[model samples]
Target: MSKSSFQGTTRRGFLAGTAALIGAPAFATQPLPVQEVEVSQGYDPLRPPPVPEPPVRHNISSFQAKHWQPYFSNLHNGAILVDTQSRALHFWSEDYESHMLFPSSVPLSDEMTRRGRTSVVRKVKGPSWSPTPSMKKRNPEWPDYIPPGPDNPLGTHALYLGWKYYRIHGTHDTRKIGRRSSNGCIGLYNEHIAKLFERAKVGTQVLLI
Candidate 1:
């Protein structure tokens, strides 16, 4: 996409605001539209769950670097490599000579993105989210469940990895994509995850480094 494609007033403002909010608290005080729940924790049950700021759609494509890498051809077709140090993911494409690589930002977190080799085990569309046991222990106020939708933390699609509680999934908060923000799962832009969902299959190897 060209730089001019993102020059509209609303788009520019959103982009600027997103850049400013990096490193800010992920949660906002605004109340979510969902029903309320009571809790023992200090959190106000009435407060809305933190939703990510509206995504600057072209920000990833505009700011993250992507390029062809013939070296990726050495990997099996459809193999994925997550380079946490670079905050990028690489997939070896079937075509070796022409377009042999696909790259996208895959943000890492100190707590998440464990270094290991795993494979895609399953895939889901509009995946639902339930806070893991550790997450609930940290914040007892979290909802028992969040159905699939805009408010859901896992966006449009999910590719379950072999590891428990870890997956390659889309994020409700696009701002978190290129940052160290997840618990253990790899996150991608909603659109990028959707495209990846269509291409990746069960048993596809995934390497994190």
Candidate 2:
């Protein structure tokens, strides 16, 4: 057969068939078997599965994953409260249960992309931090992986946000916390930040005053 004729049969035939099937009487074809759906915590098979959403990137660090165990290390258990004017962060025990992690104040900064100076920008679990252009230039010798241990420059754990590429994190540089001494990042004692890392969650309301 000629190419044109052949194309018509294949393409048109398929479309015709589709329309017929779709337009046929609802019961013209054999009835489909019906099954009941079982419910589960996070998934459902009976109904169409939900469309997945793209994941958001947090700028914390792998250093957060390994170094600190803040899951249960707070006076209030991993809740962050920041006083922007004072430049301090507080990690209190969560409301449900209780144990103070650290009540001592640590200076903070509003080096983020927010409109005005503020603290407690946002909270996330093990946030991810990508270095700023200037940071990479300054620390050209910085390593590929900020490793999951204490000595990592991201410190023991890191909560990174815009404020001039500043991160609220642990540091072997404990001396820097209550001071405005980061490349615009917040510096906490290596041990202290670790505690914050353990207790904080991805969306634990970060109150900034």
Candidate 3:
């Protein structure tokens, strides 16, 4: 072939190879089309998605588990710590293998509050209720006796403390838990107190703080 013809052929081959290299990347890197979701009835394509409402929060800053060592000299016959500040109860079995924490209702005010150490002298299931003289004096209309049942304020179980007129017991009214709503006793939910009753014995060491 002639030199001019040869040069023209070479230039055509170079241009074809360069074009293929450039076009290959453009096609290879192309993005896939996004599939459209099926719209339900009343759906608005122009409207933004709904924002969810924030979760409701309760005042439970100190509602956490605690170790059983600091408050008790020993875990003899099991130990219970009632934290009035946190509105919680901590229990540890005599063996120290079982530990449980529960929300509690403390006394309504300083006058009704009792702090210090005590022991469970009695455990009564379906305990009867009677307002103390002071309680009745404060509220004359209060009932003199409440039989063991749903209406009883002592709830399903009661762990009578060493101190008179004091007990760690259950309450049928769930709203009282995790608050200061009791007279002089530490109160737990009926279900929680039932469980604690099974774990605690007659001589369980108790401390209220």
Q: Which has the greatest TM-score? A: 3
TM-score list, all predictions:
0.62, 0.42, 0.71
Best by lDDT: 3
User: For model 2, what is the error of residue 169's alpha carbon versus the real structure, in angstroms, after optimal superposition?
Assistant: 1.3
lDDT of 2 by residue, 1-209 (tens): 11111111122443454245455332123322322222212211111222231222111111010111232243232355554444445444454333222212233234442332333344443444445676567666554344444344455466654354545665543334333444545555545565566666554444444
RMSD of each: 12.6, 24.9, 27.5
**Rank by lDDT (best first):** 3, 1, 2
Model 1: which residue pairs collide? 32-48
TM-score, model 1 to reference: 0.62
Report lDDT per candidate: 0.57, 0.39, 0.69
Worst 10 residues of 1 by lDDT: 35-44
In model 1, which runs have C-alpha deviations exceeding 4 angstroms? 1-77, 94-109
